[model samples]
Target: MKKIMVVLMVCLMVLNGCTKDNTQDYTKVSNQTYLLGTLVKVTVYGKDVSKEVFNGAFDIIKNIEATVSKNEDNSEVSQINKGQEISLSESTYKIIEKGLYYSQVSKGKFDITIAPLVNLWGIGTKNAKVPSHEEIQEAIKKINYKHITLDQKTNKIQIHQPIELDLGAIAKGYVADEVSAYLMEHNMGHAIINLGGNILTVGEKPDGSSWKIGIQNPFDARGTKLGVVTIGQKSVVTSGIYERYLEEGDKQYHHILDPFTGYPVENELASVSIISNLSIDGDGLSTVVFSMGLEEGFDFIEGLDEVDAIFVTKDKEVYLTSGADEIFMLTHEDFKKKQMKK
Candidate 1:
């Protein structure tokens, strides 16, 4: 399975400064709003567009976030976690269903019932601290997706045990997908959406060019670009350990917690970028592949269909899968390219 694909021995350099103030096109309309605990930006290309167009698209994101956000006390996910049997909206049910599907496909590598572990770690909050080994062991016991039960008829979600579900990995992807669907329905010629790094392009640019998404340099705190993934009308989502971390003393712990270990996934890869037609798939699989480590991560990607990954090891070596070469183009010469799978 280890075969060399298109290996381009090209010099990859970072862009000096963005020449375009917004997107490459001027007819495209864009709006930014706060949702899903992050900044959500949507751009659409066409004429005679009202503010409601963007507002309507953003409303879908807001409604879904309010439903599944684990932090909200009145959220449906929160209610379900509290042992109350409740019915979910179609949107809510579909995301949880997709979340469970990824969990099963990853064989527990990606789980929605890992909120207990998240709360225990509290990586992004002021409560972030290292918990006792016993506490981690206790949290691990509840990190099973099988503990959640969903009824298709009534659209109800029930937690069998004290399990909690966190849809952070998949929610933004789903939101992006929803926004894209809306854009397509409205016959938007070209658009780009950046929901705090989870990017989705609608159709192509007016000039019919692929969207150049910068893969963030994990080692740089200034959010520098290490490479660019050229894509057209696809979702490019990169998950990294650099985003949110807890610094206790001299050690650093990232937010991507392992479901089985109840700790940050310790691997040679610093970040993993997943590309697919659907942002949900890219979003969910990025974390799963990260948790699987470099060796097993490539194996997992090979078994999948229409999915590609870019692995940036802790040593700064960039690895691209077979199909990844179609979109991934390196921008940093300091990083060496590793041999990819067939």
Candidate 2:
């Protein structure tokens, strides 16, 4: 899922840097928070056309939320949650189909069938609380991507076991891609789609320049800088433990849990960001890499030609694949020196 706190922090920083006289005409829309979460921002560069483009983009986002939201009473996902076979919109069905495929590709690391465990922990909900060992085991028993049955003929979905399907990890990127496609089809030349940190840059600025995207520092929430990446038309997605988390006594629990253990994966990684041509691919890959840890993720990225990854370990050590080094620009002198030494 998109980290709410980190995105808000980035927005606050961006807004503080901009003056009212120089603010761009950006239309922002946020879904119901603490539930099936999603936020979309569309900015178009044209006179009297900003509102029209924004409305068009907003419509697409709303349609996606309605189709995929688990909290929606009549949504296809909600029906799956209730263990009822239901027909879904072609778009929604395609997303679920892709999700299951990715789950297999990642060796069950990226799972949409994790809704039961997510709800049990209430990570992003008002009732956010931890669950007992027994409770988690029971939830895992019902959590299996193989249990989701799809009928290609009718586009119907059937849950072989009692489970809830949550696409929180992948839906935002898919929505962003959809909105970007809509804008391009409608003659939008230059735009930026910031779905609350799941950013996708389409075309370029009207002045013909690449969009500047800053990578958030995983350790210090407000202090330190990671680096910056320039993109003309690409997606940048970062998944970190510092995002949505809960503290209890002297320990802390993050929302990104492992389906195998029904607890957060214990690893040295602080965050992993992926850049790809498609936002949905980047979104799904980021989660998969995080769960796989540094070495395995590194090996996996090295095999892919079109994808690049940036990983920050718990020791504050940074690792970037060769593909990532092309777009990543180190702003900190010390970081630059460290890279040179390596």
Error of 1 at 101 (Å): 1.2
On lDDT, the candidate that comes out on top is 1
lDDT of 1 by residue, 43-145 (tens): 7766666798898898888888889899889999898788788889887898899999989987998899888888888766668789999999999998899
TM-scores for the candidates: 0.90, 0.87
TM-score for predicted model 2 compared with the true structure: 0.87
lDDT of 2 at 311: 84
Query: Considering summed lDDT, which 10 consecutive residues are worst modelled in model 1?
Result: 1-10
| Decoy 1 TM-score against native | 0.90
> Model 2, range 18-49, lDDT digits (tens) per residue?
12443465323222222125445566654346
lDDT of each: 0.78, 0.74
List the pairs of residues colliding in candidate 1: 12-331
Error of 2 at 263 (Å): 0.4
In model 1, the number of clashes is 1
10 residues in a row with least lDDT, candidate 2: 10-19
